[model samples]
Target: MALFVQPWPIFLSINYLGLQACFLRVFMKIKLNNVCIFPLAQILNCVVYCIFVAMAAGLPFLNPYKSTDDADFRHGVNFAVAGSTALPTEILASENILSPVTNSSLSVQLGWMSTHFNSTCKTRGGWCVNQIKYLSFFLKQSTYCVEKLKNSLFMVGEIGGNDYNYALLPGKSIEEVKKIVPNVVEAIKNAVRRVIHYGAVRVIVPGNFPIGCFPIYLTRFQTNDTAVYDEDQCLKELNDFSKYHNDNLRRAIKDLKNEFPNVVIVLFTIILIFCFVMLYTGFDVMSLQKACCGIGGNYNFSLTRMCGAGLPVCSNPNQHISWDGVHLTQEAYKFMTGWLIRNMLHKLQCSV
Candidate 1:
């Protein structure tokens, strides 16, 4: 839902030429460069040096890349990985999820940029680009990457939520935030249009997650009035607002699909999967409400003291959906990914 990370761990598992494959080639060129630019730059540099030393001693990046040419008789075979970070579990997850289909085959071509609405191109001041203006910038920088993938998938968003959050977090009412929905949807439509112009054929645009379920929202909007709460203890009105955005977004995608007849635009359905996961994993309202990693108040979230050194982490992260107030845990992301692969693969047109 607007989970901001250091960008090094960002990866999207996608299908290419009707086969399960890794898409890390796009990051390979910048692999060394990212080590210097990311937040843990110094630590990564030390690790990079060690890798170079090991490589110099004859450890190759691709020890043995493998694939098969034989066509299957019945079902389609897909690939994926899970978990996080640099440890064995996380490394294995990254390796499986981000691995390429074949050694000789080129990796998926894609690019991404993380920034806010006012900064992307909305109301440009001096050197800054707003959300609307970011399209031109994206097109200029991403032509080569887009061109390389003859059959490409463009992920337009989990955006606009931040824009709404910008409005709401500063004490705006739900009605006021609702009024700005059109502007947000329009920006997304414009983004999809630009991507189509630059040759994206399949795009999977995700709607916002249930913002009402966020710990930040829960804590901020808390009231003694139990009537205002949902069964999950999230603010009912806020979740309704998120649903409003999804409704308009689906409508926009439908119109866009009709105009660009060849492009396959799908709205990623996240809410249903989230609800299903919570139930499937046996988490109740109390278990789901608090942050898995944080300190202080009822939601275990603080505006000043976030989850970091000296903060308390929950005994079991697997029981919690959120890692902190505003973000999901690695376990939660893994569950969602697996669920998406199983359910949305057909809708995404990745399965035959």
Candidate 2:
């Protein structure tokens, strides 16, 4: 059920706000520099993890794994690119879905991981042969990359959301988007397999969030029929689609566990956490499906005048769950992160 492990270094391959919450929990546990030091823009863009890791390690914050720079891998490296998907560009394109943001998919992130290892380790015949000299002082000497990675935690996802986002936002029917779940899960499975092969003893692969509960989807898919909405006012069809994705992903993770009994693969139920927060009395239920930073519409969301485009932000973002139309606010993330840590720390088999 859990992998009893030490305080291992974290190697992140993530995307989206759900996994960002988990990273924030780790950052806080490590007692890193105040997260406020990094701009919110950078945090939303998935570029703050390495900076926090670097800062925690007492290293220069400026050299936190930029593509052009030599990344200091003393603590960890983040391979998450915001707006990246689990599915490849070509696959999405074939479905007539276009990725408007960066083309860094799960495969691209894995490629970056490979490149990082290649630079850090001594390789022979394209395989890491000896312990990395620079990392030797920090980590125990291991002959191969796999051995080195055993002491690392791999946060594989909360990816594939953008795949759905790209598809759904472009007017693809829920049924059509539902078909994308298999390929997306397969892509994630392949990524997990690769990380396990690279010697990841513990891996946390999170599922999709309840997108129907978000302001973006609510605004976009508003219907006249009250029957289509749930008790929480979320679109029933969209929430079911999210469940469909999570179910498929859960099955994939089970298969991976069977294949690699030695590895600890965790399926972080992000939707369940969202549900808990929604049901809790403390959360501002009135604004549960509204954007904290946006303008117009019933859900305070507008595709034309999106958040961070100098629109009128709410006076207190802490009172709202949704940050923009899509993402969660910092307070929402903080609360979710706290819940996640309490629930997952035992499963992760790690101490504070």
Give the TM-score of each candidate: 0.61, 0.82
Residue 106 in candidate 1, Cα distance off native in Å: 28
Candidate 1 per-residue lDDT, tens place, 1-352, comes to 1111000111111111211231222221222321222233211211221122112222222110112444221111111111111112222233232312221111111122222111232323334455456757655545433443324344454556655665577677888768768866776676666546645566666677788888888888889999889886778998899999989999999999999987777777667677776668665457686887687778888767767667777786657777777766545655565554445446646533
Best by TM-score: 2
Give me the runs in candidate 1 sitting further than 4 Å from their true place. 1-147, 283-285
Query: Taking the tens digit of each residue's C-alpha lDDT, what string does model 2 give over 1-352?
Result: 0011112233334311112113333445654222354445522422232333333323343322344666545545566666788887998999999998878787887876666666665444322324444455334333644454655566677788899999998799999888888999998899888867766777878788899898888888888999999998999898899999999999999999999988878888889988887778376877888887788889999877787756777786667778787877666665565665566656756554
lDDT assessment of candidate 1: 0.50
The Cα local distance difference test for each model comes to: 0.50, 0.67
Prediction RMSDs, each to the true structure: 15.9, 5.8
